[model samples]
Target: MKRMLLMGIALLCISCQGIAQEKKEEKKQFPITKTDAEWKAELTNMQYYVLRRAGTERAFSSELLENKDKGTYVCAACETPLFKSKHKFRSGTGWPSFDREIKGNVAFDVDYNIGYARTEEHCATCGGHLGHVFDDGPKKTTGKRHCINGAALKFVPENE
Candidate 1:
């Protein structure tokens, strides 16, 4: 009888842990929130896919990857400045790579979509999906590559 009681207590403890784990995944609040329809109406199809749905664009398909002009990369969803022109680099990874974000404008979360944990980036203002940041970057700089989707961003020239 004592063993049975102990087993029940152990099971209760295990179940409580599961509940705690589930709570960790609760929807996070962002500074800006919008309805799905509102987002669809505002963003183009590619922007909607990469930002709203967390879908990835095909490699080498972004026009912004080759942009050499000085500008700020802003979130497509909320126009929040995310990266500076100076931080951008030629990672040759077929995506627009930045050594660092503008800070405070970007947020992060861990995603295991492909069965491996990856550091996912997001627009802090609207929680729009941006891309993933990897540790493999220029050794001379931050040594972090922010492989962002061009569809998730808008270029704002400095003079503008």
Candidate 2:
């Protein structure tokens, strides 16, 4: 029947759209790129896992959680300034939480690795996976919580 044939074609077109989206994500390119071997040589195993492979560190395992010093957090891979010390907060989520990032230094994307969409944040310069952002934050502030992996960042003290 012509109706049946049209339905099948429509289904095929819908499936093709899904495939195209996956391909687009696979081909994403960053401004700063390096060979896998070079990244391996330059980073520690944990840093490589978190930054280059889009991996998450264990909760409550980062020393930055308890850090009270004045400084800025930079991307471990590219040294891009991410969050300032003043913006950091205790979100009790076992990760370094920030009220915001330095404008234009961080980039946002969607991740579905957990079978749901999450707002993924990354280093704009190197495209390293930083972490996720949420809406539950201080009401007087940006109302954004940037829950970042400490391994994906390097702290630079203000005095230094």
Candidate 3:
């Protein structure tokens, strides 16, 4: 009977260890990670504030709002390709707006900074805060308005 009891306890311990291992595996680690000092050194003041601290840029302040060129928008922190020029549209929100992001390059989370839940978007590689997404977009496409901060992105012209 003692041997049987010992075996049962061992089985329970094994199951608990398996559960712990699964929980550890479920946590995500980004491909790009930098120390806070390194990030601050690499990014401009506004970029660091917006991307790392989740600060919003003033509306209509971004030159990207007026850009009509053919290019791709990359994460300012990690240079990960995020949005294409073709997906961009004038949301008139004064920020650079996109209809969609490059698949698997962006991650979404919930934000309640204003006392309501909103879908927040970030760069998948470095987990930099890009901006929030909304449903108010042109109905002809994906119906997602990925309203992004200009400071969080760097445009690469297609020719380059």
Q: Report lDDT per candidate.
A: 0.94, 0.92, 0.93
- Model 1 bad stretches (over 4 Å): 1-24
Q: What is the clash tally of candidate 2?
A: 0
Candidate 1 local lDDT, 115-143, one digit each (tens): 78899999999999999999999999999
Descending-TM-score candidate ranking: 1, 2, 3
For residue 158, model 2's alpha carbon misses the true position, in angstroms, by 0.5
In the range 35-101, model 3's lDDT, one tens digit per residue, is: 8999999999999999999899999998788999999999999999999999999998999999999
Global lDDT of model 1: 0.94
User: Which ranking of candidates, highest lDDT first?
Assistant: 1, 3, 2
Candidate 1 lDDT score at position 117: 86
lDDT of 2 by residue, 71-96 (tens): 99999999999999999999999999
Q: State the local distance difference test value for candidate 2.
A: 0.92
Clashing pairs in 1: none
Q: What is the TM-score of each candidate against the true structure?
A: 0.86, 0.86, 0.82
Pairs with steric clashes in candidate 2? none
